[model samples]
Target: MQASGYSFKELLGFDIAVLSELFSSYTTLDATRHNELMLYFEGVNKAWNHPGFTFLYHYQQYVELDAEPYSYTRFFEHYRRKYPKEKGSMKLQHIAGEEMFVDFAGKKLQIVDKHTGEVIAVEVFVAILPCSQYTYIQACRSQKREDMISCCTAALRFYGGSPKGIVSDNLKSAVNRSSRYEADINRSFKDFARHYNCVINPTRSYAPQLFNIKTIYNI
Candidate 1:
C-alpha cells in the first residue's frame, strides 16, 4: 500500500525490471570455486613455488575459469582467516620430568678480573622444568656450540635426572636447520641428547611465540 492511498506501482515511475531485485533471492557462490581456491592456497603454503611467490601470481592461473576468481583482498582475507602462522593455541600437557625449556637471557652478566681490572660479559643460560617450574641458571662465556652443550649437560646433572625431552629455540649452536614442520638438530647437540636419553625438540624456526620459555612455564 502507498502512503498517498495509491498503489506503489502507480505512484512510482519505474517498471518491474528495477523492482524485481527486491523480491529476488540471493544465491551463494558455487562451492567448487571455494574448494579450488583452497587448493591453490595450500599448494603455495606447502612451498610448491618460490619463496617470493604471491597470491596475485597464482590467481592468474584461474583467469580462464567460468566463474570470476576472488579478488586479491578477498583471497588474502580467506587465507589468513583459515591458515594462521601457527595452529591456534592448544593446551600443552607437561608431565613431571617430561620436558625442559632452555634459552639464553638477553641481558648479560659481567665478571671483573681483580688483577687486570678487566670486565668480561657472560651469557646467562636458563633452563626451566615445565611441570615443576624449577629453573636452573648458569653463566657461560658465549652461545657457542660447546658452551650451550656444556650448560645443558650441567643443567641436566643438576636436576639429577634427565627429562624425556629438551625444548629449545633455533639457535645456530643447537639447531642445524629450523623449519615449521621439522627442525634438524646440530650433530653435537643430537649426540648430547642421545647420551642423556632425551630428545631435542626445537620450536618453529621463525615463530617465537612457540619458543617463549617463560610463557610456556608461566614464569
Candidate 2:
C-alpha cells in the first residue's frame, strides 16, 4: 500500500500491532503486473469504509470466493478445518511451552575464539516466545544444519521446555524442498521435530504476512 502511495487510516478498530505488522510487511512489495494485488486490497478496504475488523474477517470468511489462489471456497474450507493460524487470528499465539521462533540474526556480530584470540564473526541466533516476547540470543557459525540445530537446542533449554511447534525460515537447514502449503522439512530439522514432538513450518519463498519472514526479509 505504501508503494502505491496509499495511507493507513486510523478508522474502524483492529489490533494495532496486527495492522502495523501487515503494513510493514507489504509496504515494500513490488506491485504485480497491473498492481492487481494492491488494487484488490485497496478496493476491499474502500468498500468496507476502511474498517479494520471488517477487512480482516472478510478475508477469513467471504472475500476469497471471487479471487484466484485464495478463492471463497478455499478460504471457507481453511476456516472450516480450524487451522490455528487461520482460525481466530492471523498471528501465532503461543500456548506456554507450545511454540518457539528461531532465526539467524543477519549482520554477524563478533564472537572471539577466546583460546586462539581469533576474531570469529559468529552469527547471532535468536528465539522468541510469541506470547511474551521473551527472547534469547547466542552466537553461532553459519546457517548450517549442525549450527542451527545446536542453537535451537540451546534456545529450547533457555526457555526451559520444548514447544509443540518450531517456526523457522525457509532456509536449507530448516526446509528440504519448497512448497506453498506443506514443504519438505530438512532432515536435521525433522529429527529435532521428532525429538521435541513439534511440527515445523517453513516460510514460503517470498510471501508476506508471515509474521517472522516479514520482519526477516525487511531487515
Candidate 3:
C-alpha cells in the first residue's frame, strides 16, 4: 500500500486522454472486433506504454461510464448516436447520348419450352441510358461474345441510336483481362463497338461505383 511514491493518476492505471483517443480512432475503423481495434490503437499510439489487455480494460470502463445501461452493445448504440456515419449519394449526371451502361442481372430468368414441359434458365442482359433513363432488356442463352454483341445491337436498335460510349462490366465476353488502370477489351466486342461507332469503356475490376446503373436508375 505504498501509494506515496506513485502519482494519483498513475495509480488509477488509465489515462483519460489515451482512452478518448482510442475511442475516437475506433469509431473510424471498419472492423468492430476489439482485438483488431487494440492492434490499430497500438500501432497509432506508440508513445503509450501499456499492455493490450490493459488498454482494452480501460476502454470497457470508459464505455460503461459514457454509455447508459452499461453494456458493450449499448456502447455501440451510444457511439453511433454521438457520431453518425455519413452516407454518400450515388446519383450521377449524364449528357444525352453520351454513355450506355450494360450489365447482366445477378438472377437468371426462367423460360418454359412450349413443346416440352421443361424450364430453362436464361441470362438477363440490361442496358440503360443514364441521361434519358431509357432501358432495354433481353434474355440470352449465355453471355458469350456473340450473344453479348447481339444484345448490344438490339439495345441500340431499340434506342434508335448508339451512344458515344458503351459502359460494360468486365465480363469475359467483353473484356479479355480486367485491370484497375486499363482493361483489355475482347477483339469481337471491339469490332462490334467500332461497327456501331461507339467506344467500349470497361469498368474497373471490382469497382461497382464506376458503373452502378441499377442503383442510379432505381432499377
Top-lDDT candidate index: 1
Q: After superposition, how far is residue 104 of candidate 3 from its true place, in Å?
A: 0.4
lDDT of each: 0.78, 0.65, 0.73
Candidate 3 lDDT: 0.73
Clashes of each: 0, 3, 0
| Predicted structure 3, TM vs. truth | 0.58
Q: After aligning candidate 3 to the native by TM-score, how far in Å is the CA of 8 from where it should be?
A: 49
lDDT of 3 by residue, 1-219 (tens): 153465556647757785565345455533445444444344334533332223345445555544223354544454445446588666578999999999887657789999997999999898988887788989999999899999999999999998999999888899999999999998999999999898999988888544443323432
- Better structure of 1 and 3 per lDDT: 1
Off by over 4 Å in 2: 1-94, 114-116, 208-219
RMSD of each: 14.7, 18.7, 14.8
Cα lDDT tens digits, model 1, 1-219, are 343465666647656775454444566867788888877777757753343344565556555552768876787788887786665577778899989998887557799989999999998898989787788999999999999999998998899999999999888899888899889788999999999999999988677443453323322
After superposing candidate 1 on the true structure, give the runs of residues whose Cα lies further than 4 Å from its correct spot: 1-91, 210-219
Off by over 4 Å in 3: 1-86, 210-219
- How does residue 193 of candidate 2 score in lDDT? 80
Ten residues in sequence with the least summed lDDT for candidate 1: 210-219
